[model samples]
Target: MKVLSMILAGFVVGYAVSDIRPFDSLLSSTAEFGSPTTIVNGLTVLALTACLVSVALARSSARGVLVVAIGAVLVVVFRTVGMVTGMFGDWAGAVGAGALLGASAVLAGRHRAAQASLAVAAIGAGLLGTALDALLQADDGPVFVWDVAGAEDAVVPERAIVMVIAALGTALSLYQAHRDVALQSHETRRTLLVGLPLPIAAGVVSWFAGGHDSGDAVWLGALAGMAVLAVVAAFALPGRDGRVLLVLFASATIGSMGFAVEDSLQLAVSVALLVVGAGIGYRWPQLYVGLGGLLVVAGASLIEGYVALPSLSQFALPFVVAYALVSVLSTAPGSLAVALPALFTMSLPVTVFAASYQAGLSLSSDNAVATRTSEPDHLVLSLAGLVVVAVVTVACAVLMRRPTQNPAAR
Candidate 1:
C-alpha cells in the first residue's frame, strides 16, 4: 500500500508538472501570460518547488507545518487560477470532489495527525486538478449527469491510476529508507550533496544551451565540463567509498545522455556518455581514477571533432553495467532513492526510442533506424572503460560491510 501511494504521488507530480494533457492548450490560452501554456508552466514550477521545499524541510531539522501548508496553498492557487480563467472548464469541479475522496484516504493512513493532514492536502490538490479536468470536458455541460462517452471503464482514470501507483511506490520507498539502511558518514554526505542540484540543474542548463548543429562545440563542451566536475569531486572526496562519486557522476551523465537523445542528435553522444559512465563503473575501482579517464575520453572526443567517432551499439553496454552496479551494491532504499531522478531523466530518451521503434515496426519500412551510436569502436572502447565503476562500488561495499577489529576505527 505504501509502495502504491508513493507511485501515485510520483505520477501525480509528473502529470501536474508536465503540460502533457490534451486540454493543456485551452489552459495555456486562459492564463494571464499571453498563452495558457505559460500559465500552466508557471503553476507547475511553483507547485513542484513548493512540494520539494516542503519535503526538504520535513526531512531536515526545521520544525514547522508552514512549508507543507504553503505547498498546499500554492497547489490550490494553481488550480484556482486554472479554473477561474477558464483553463479548467468543468475540470475544476472534479478537483473539489477528488479532494474529498483523497482527504478520506489521508485520514486513514498511519501517519501522525499533522503528517496525515499534509498528505490529505496533497491528495486534495491532486483530486481537485483531476476533477477540474474532468468537469471541463464533460459531454453534457454542467447538468450533473454522469457522462460515460469519453470515460474509460476503469475505476481510476489511466493517468490518475499511473500517478497513484507512482505515489505508492514513493511512500514505500520512504518507509524503507526509515527502516534499517545504514551508510558510512562520508557516503551519506556524498549522497546528499549529489542529490541536491545535479539532477535538475544539469538538465535545465543542457536543455537551454543545446545546439542543433551536428558537431556543435557546445555538446562536447558540456561533456567535458561534466568530466571535469566528476574528476574534481572524486579527488576532493577520495575516501574508500569513491563509488558514491561514480553514482553521482553516472546520474549527471545520464541526464546529459537524455538531453542528447531528446535533441535527436545524429552524433550519438548519448551512447558515448553512457559507455564512458559504465566503463568508469566497471573498472579502475575508484571514482577518482575513473573520473580521470572519463575526462581524457571526453577531451579526446572534443578534440577529434565529429567525423572520427565509433559505433553506437557500444554505448548501451555502459548503462547496463552501471545499472547492474546500482542494483547490486546499494541497499534497496538507497538504490531506489538515488535512482529516482536519474531514472526519471533516462526515461525521456527511453520513451522516445521506444516510440521510434514502434513507429518503425508499424510502417514495415526498410529505412534504417537512425543510429544513436557515434561510432562502433568508440562505443566498445568506452564500454570497456565502464568496468571501473562496478569494481569500485563492489569493493567499497564489501570493505564497508566488514567488521572492524580496531577500536579506533569502530
Candidate 2:
C-alpha cells in the first residue's frame, strides 16, 4: 500500500509536469500570441511556476497533499470552464496542474527508501504522458505543431480523467504517509533559499532568449550559463539535496536525446524503453554504473546522429536516461522538492537553447543550399556537456558512497 501510494503520487506529478499542450492551445487562440515562441514562453512559465511552488512548499507533507488535492480539483474545473467559455480556463487549469506537480513531488519525496520506485514511476509516466500527448494532438507532420488554435480541446477529456486519478492518488498517498511513514519535520535551510535564485535567473534568461532573433551565439551562451548555474546551485545546496540535484542535472543533460525524437512510433518505443530501464534501475540502483552506461549511450547517440542509422537505435537513449535517473535517485540523499524542481527549472533554458540552436543550424544550412542531410551541431554540444556531467556524476557518486556525519541531514 505504501509503495503503491508513492507510485500514484509519482504518476500524477509526472503527468502534470509533462502535459502542457492545453496551455499552448490557449496561447494560440489569440492572433498576437499565435507564434511558436510565444507558446513556448507561456508553457515555460507554467513549468517554472511548478518548480518555484515545489521549492517554496517543501517542508510539510500535509500542506503539500492539501495543495495537490486543491490543484487537481482546480484543473478539472478550469479545464471544463475553458471548454465551455473559451476564456482563461486553460491558463488557470495549467496553473492548477502545476501546483499538483509541485505538491505531489513533496509528498512523494517524504517516502524515504521508496523514493527510487517513485522516481522511476514519475519519469516513466512523464515520458509516457509526452508520447500520449503527441500521439493524440499531433497533426500530419513529424514534429508537434503548436500553432493550432483548438488543440487544448482535444485533450480536455483526457486531462480531466488524469486529474481525477491524481486526486485519488494524492488521497491514498496522504493516508499512507500518516498511517505508516515515519514523518519528519525538516529544518528550514539557508541553502534552500540560496538555491532558489539560480532557477529564477535561468527562467528569465530562457524566456528572453526564446523571444530574441539573435544568432546562435546568444543561445549557446545562455545554455552554457544555465549549465554552470545548475552546477553551482547543486553544490550550494547542502547534503543529499546537493548530491541528488547534481545527479538529476546530469541525467537531464544527457537525456536530451530522448526529448529530441520526433516520430510517433519511435516515441512510443522510447517510452516503453523508459519503463523497462526504470525497472532495471530500481532492481540494481548503482549510481556509478548507471552513470557510466548513460554516458556510453549518450556518446553512441551523438555518433548515430551524424551517421546513417537504423531507427531502432533511437530507443536506447530513453532507456539509459531512465536507468540513470532511477539509479541516482535510489542512492542519492536529498529533498525531492529541491532536486526535482531544480531539474525542472533548469531544463527550461537548456531545452529552449538547444531547440534554438538546432533551428539556427537548420536555417543556416538551408540558406546555403546544402544538399547532404545530417544532424544539427547541437548533438556535439550535448555530447560535450555529457562529458562534463559524467565527471560531476563521478564526484557526487563518490561523496554519496561515504557515510554522512549526520544521518539526520539525509
Candidate 3:
C-alpha cells in the first residue's frame, strides 16, 4: 500500500510541476505588454493558490505537503528577485518573510519552545527593523542625505509594515492573554518595555550611523506605528491591551509630533485626531491614555501658538488654559501619576527642540513691526517650559508619595 501511495504521489508531483511551468513562457511571450510584473504577479498568485490547494489536498495522500508549499515559495522568490525587484521593490523578500512569519505563528500554536522563541523573534523583529533602517538609511554623513523635506510618501509604506507587525503582535498578545496560555500580562509588558527604548536608541544610533534626514524608514515607521497604536489603544482595545498600548504609544510620542507634522495647521489636525482618540481613551478604564491625549493637545498647541501666533503671551496663555483643561477632564483616581510623567516626557523635549529649531532658521528682516525677537523669545519659552516640567514632576512626586501602611493599621 505504501509503494502504491508513493507511486501516486510521484505522478501527482510530476503533473503539478509540468502544469505550473507555463508561467515563464506566458511571461516571456507578453513582455511587450503594460507590465511584465503585473502579468508575472498574476501568474504567481495563481500558482500560489494552486500550491496551497495541493498542500491541503495532498496531506492525506503524502507526507510531502510542506515541501510543496516550500517549493511554491521558492518559485515566487525566484520570480520576485529576478523580475519584481524593479517593479515591486523586492516583493519576493517580503512574501518570503511573511511566509516565515506565518510558519512561526503556526509552530507557536503547537509547541512550547516555538511559542517562546517566536515571541522573542517578534519582539526582536519590531526593534531590529528600526535599528536596521537607521543603520542602512542613514545618509547624513559623507554619503550625503537625500530626501524631500517633510515627505510622507516614503514613510507611508514603512508605516504600513510597522503597523502590520504591531497589529499582529497585538492580536497575538491579546490571544495569548485570552488563552491563559504561555504569554500573559507580564510577557505583554515585557514586549512593550522592549519596544519603548528602541526608538530612542535607534535615533541615537542613526545619528551615528549616518542617518539621512534624521533616520530613515525605521524612525519614521516607529513614529507612525506608535501614533497608530495610541489611537487603537485609546479607542479599539480595552483593559490590559489598552494599558500596554499606552506605554508603547507614549514611548514614541515624545519628540515625534513636531517632526511628524509640517506646521501649525497640520499639528492642529493631528491634535484633532488625538482629541477623537482622547474621547476613545476616556471611556476606557485607564484615564492615562486620555490624559496622554490632552498632553498631545497641550504640546501641539504650544508649538502651533508659538509659530503662528505673534505674541508669546497669546500661545502661552492658551497653553495654560490647556493645562487647566487637562486637569478638569482627567477622570481617574490614580491617573495623576501617569499624567504627570507623560506630560513631562511629551512636552519638554518637543517644546525645547521646536523652539531651538525655529531659533536656528533665519528670521524675516522685514518684520520691523514686531517688537520682541522671535529667536530669543522662543528660546526663553523653551527654558520656561523646561522649568515648569521640572517643577511639576517634583511636585507630583512629592504629592503622590505616601508612607507605607503596616498590615496592622488596616
Candidate 4:
C-alpha cells in the first residue's frame, strides 16, 4: 500500500512539475512577459536542495548527512539571494525565510532532527512554489502554429516545481514509512541496471529506421523495448509498480502504431490497437502506461489527420477515448491540466472533419448510392471506441478504490 501510494505520489508530482516549466526553448515562449531564466535557475537549485534534504534527513548514514548539509547550505544561499534580489516577498516569503534559520537551530537537537529537516524541506518547497508564479510572468515570444491550434503554446509554459516537490516529499515519506524501500532496496538497485538501456536502445533504433518501411519496424522495436523494461521492472520491483510501467508503455506503443497505419485501414487497426491497449490496461492498470498510450494515440491521430491519410471523422473516437482515458488514469493534477489543452487542440480537427462528413453525406443524392456507401462507416465505430474508454475508466476507478492487505508492513 505504501509503495502504491509512493508511485501515485511520484506520478502526480512529476506530471505537475513537468507541466508548468519549459524544458527547452522550442517547448516554450519567453519573449512577452520577461526572461524565465531567473525563476528556472532558482527552482533548479531549490529542487536539488529538496531532493538532497529529503534523502539526507531520512537516512542516518555519513554520506546522507553530508548531502543534508550541502542541501541546507543551498537553501540558505538561494533564499538569501532571492531576498536580496527582491524576488521573495510578503508574508509567505517572510515565513519561509524565518523557517530557514529556525530549521538550522532545530536540527541541532537530535530528538527533533526529523522535524527540523521537514521544516527546512517545507521552506525550500514554499520558496520554489513562489518562484513558479514569478516564472509565469516570464516573457513569451510570438505565437507559433501550435499556439493557434491549441497545441503546445509558447505563451504559457508549465513549470516543474510541483513535480519536484511531490517526488522529493514522496521519496522521503516512503523511505520513512518503510526502511526496506529506501535507495539501497534490492528493487531500487536492480532497477538501476535494467531501466538504463532498454528505452535508450529502442529510441535509437526507432530513429534510425526513419520515414520508410511503413512504421512497422519502429513499432516492433518500441514493443520489444517496453517488454524488456517490463521484465526488468517486474523482476526488480515485482508488484504494482512494475505492472504500471508495463501497461503504460505497451498501450502507448500499440495505440501509436494503430494511428500510424494506412489511413484507409485506420479504423480496423485503431480498433485492434485500442483492444490490445485496453486489455493491457485492464490486466495491469498501470497509470503511466495508460497515460503514455493515450498521448501516443492522440499524437498519431493528429498527424494522420494532417496528412489526409485518415478521414478527419475517423479520429474523433480515438481523440475522445484517449484524452478521457488519460484524465482518469493519471493521478497527477498537473498532467491532467496540461492534457486538457492538447485535448482541445486535437478535438478541433476531428470535430471539423466530422461535421463536414455529415454535411457531405446529407448533401448526396439518392442516386449516388456508391457515395453514400463509401461515406466511411467510421463514425459509429469511433463512438464505440469512446464507449470503451468510458467503461475502462469506471472500472479503473472502482479497482483503485478497493482495499488491499499488505503483509509486508505487518
TM-score of each: 0.37, 0.71, 0.25, 0.31
TM-score attained by model 4: 0.31
- Model 3 residue runs over 4 Å out of place are 1-84, 110-113, 123-410
lDDT by residue (1-410, candidate 4, tens digit) is 33332332323322322222222121123422123321222223223222233322332443343333334333333333232223332222222222222222112212122221232233222313333434444355222221122222232323323333444554454344444422221122223233333333333333322212223334334334434544453334322223323333333332322233332244344444443433443345445345444444445444554476654333443432332342233211111111111111111011111111223445563332211111212332233233333433343444455443221210
C-alpha lDDT values of all predictions: 0.34, 0.55, 0.30, 0.31
Q: After superposition, how far is residue 82 of candidate 2 from its true place, in Å?
A: 3.9
Against the true structure, what is every candidate's RMSD?
A: 14.1, 7.1, 21.0, 17.1
| Number of backbone-clashing residue pairs for each candidate, in the order shown | 61, 1, 3, 20
Residue range 1-410, candidate 1, lDDT tens digits: 43333334433443443322321333445543223243233322332333233223322221122223223323433343342224353244223222322221222222222222223223223323444345434564333324223322432243343343434454444344333322121123433444444444444433322322213244445544544444443333323223444454453343223222222232244434443543444443343444444444444433334466553323442343343332222221221233232322211111111112324555566444542312223343233234433443455454455442211111
Which 10 successive residues of model 2 have the least lDDT summed?
367-376
What is the C-alpha lDDT profile of model 2 across 1-410, one tens digit per residue? 65676667666656665654422445556633225444343345445555555555545556545556455545634463244234366566556655655555555544544675566666666656766655655675344323322435444454455556665665656575644434344433533454446555665555444443534566556556766776676655555456666666666556544454566766667667777887787778776776777577566666767788764434676677667667655322234554664445555333323222223455455332322112226565556556657666766765675554342332
User: In model 3, which range of ten residues has the least summed lDDT?
Assistant: 331-340
Write down the RMSD of candidate 4 (Cα, Å).
17.1
Write model 3 residue lDDT over 1-410, tens digit each, in one string.
22222222222222222122211323343443233332333223332332223222321222232333343344333332243333243334333423333222321222222332332223223222333334334454123234323322333233233333433443333333323323111112222232233323333322222222222334334334434433432322212222322432333233222323333443344334433433333333233333344344345445754587533332232223222222223211111111111211222112111211223235653322322111223433333333333333333333324332111100
User: Cα deviation in Å at residue 405, candidate 3?
Assistant: 35
- Better-scoring candidate (TM-score), 1 or 3: 1
Cα error, candidate 3, residue 73 (Å): 6.8
Question: Which residue pairs collide in model 3, if any?
Answer: 138-210, 138-211, 139-212
